[model samples]
Target: MSATSDAYRIEPVTPAVKDYLRLRQQAGLSPFSEEAATRGLAGSIFGVSLMQGAEIVGMGRIIGDGGCFYQVTDIAVLPEHQGRGLGKRIMSALADYMQAHLPATAYVSLIADVPANRLYQQFGFVETAPRSLGMAMKIGAPESL
Candidate 1:
């Protein structure tokens, strides 16, 4: 692992379709078929992946219309490398990108995975209950309810 506090680098995902699929699978963060990732890679309004040497140790993505709203999605960190605050690094990068580029009240958001919600809150995310409820429509299990 070439990742250190100093060497960690994050940039918007490139055409590294293979690396994205591999790490997302290893992290148990829902595997994307190679073609799906390649397609969605282009669909991303914004995204970031943490690279150390040739390995993608952390990743996150944003999906939405670029101008008015966005949803932060697909956040993952390799299991072997968890608990080092790498997810924070990923989120920080994403948040910075949002803050620098989005307009006032642009409404960036994400569906946090429990404890990960804490990390997001530090970066100005919050739970909105009465305002709205979060819902999902699993692609394969359309009638999952």
Candidate 2:
């Protein structure tokens, strides 16, 4: 949906556990087990979803220790809805939340994957390289269930 269209709306609500898993997968993100999602999402500080009627077509979340550290993550928009500015809508809501709720000195960060990093730049996110880099490792079994 277009940004000016009334057909789409962004809501300050955490997605259902199933929707979280599904949206991430559909958006080509890493897979999370039901157990992992249940535990992880329960700790979310804030989240928002883009809805076209009742369907959640996009999502973004801030998940981290609520005090000194916060990470902007879980950004995903369904493949069919990618180019209509939905990702920006999700980030706009997240940015608004951070601006309103976060402490002045809170450390906010995000790991932007390739092309998506460009969209993040519009929201004032800058790259931190030659000093610190984003890193990750998969836990548990080698194969996903």
Candidate 3:
């Protein structure tokens, strides 16, 4: 198959739950158990898949309370398919969805790893540091939650 970025078609569909998990694992993101993945994906507000002839080459998802909070997560493209601008394609779809669907008072956010964070800036995502920092804790861990 051609490795060109434009070769893939981005579709508005929930990817298979297993594909979602595998893509994340392949992309070096944290793993989610089968039950957790199933439940989490079931609650996604919207998702997009970059398809190469019925195969999910890439994917992204939006999750959160529909009205007030939304997060862009699980942005993953297969390693063999990386660097063809698929990440931008994924975020573009998500940004369009937010513009059309989100309430004006709603907050949209993402925790971008370095370098990937630069791509997100084009979509107007600003860092939330120096005023209020982003923080998190694993559930049930001894550390403060």
Candidates' lDDT values, in order?
Answer: 0.80, 0.89, 0.89
lDDT of 1 by residue, 44-100 (tens): 877788877676777888788878889988788888778778888888888888888
Off by over 4 Å in 2: 1-5, 141-145
Report the C-alpha displacement of residue 87, candidate 1, in angstroms.
Answer: 0.7
- The residue ranges of model 1 lying beyond 4 angstroms of the native Cα positions read 1-3, 143-145
Instruction: lDDT winner between 1 and 3, please give it.
Output: 3
TM-scores of the candidates are 0.87, 0.92, 0.93
Cα lDDT, model 1, residue 134: 81
Q: List the residue pairs that clash in candidate 3.
A: none
Highest-TM-score candidate:
3
lDDT of 3 by residue, 6-112 (tens): 67889998788789888889988887788888999899999999998879988999999999999999999988999888899999999999999999999999888
TM-score of 1: 0.87
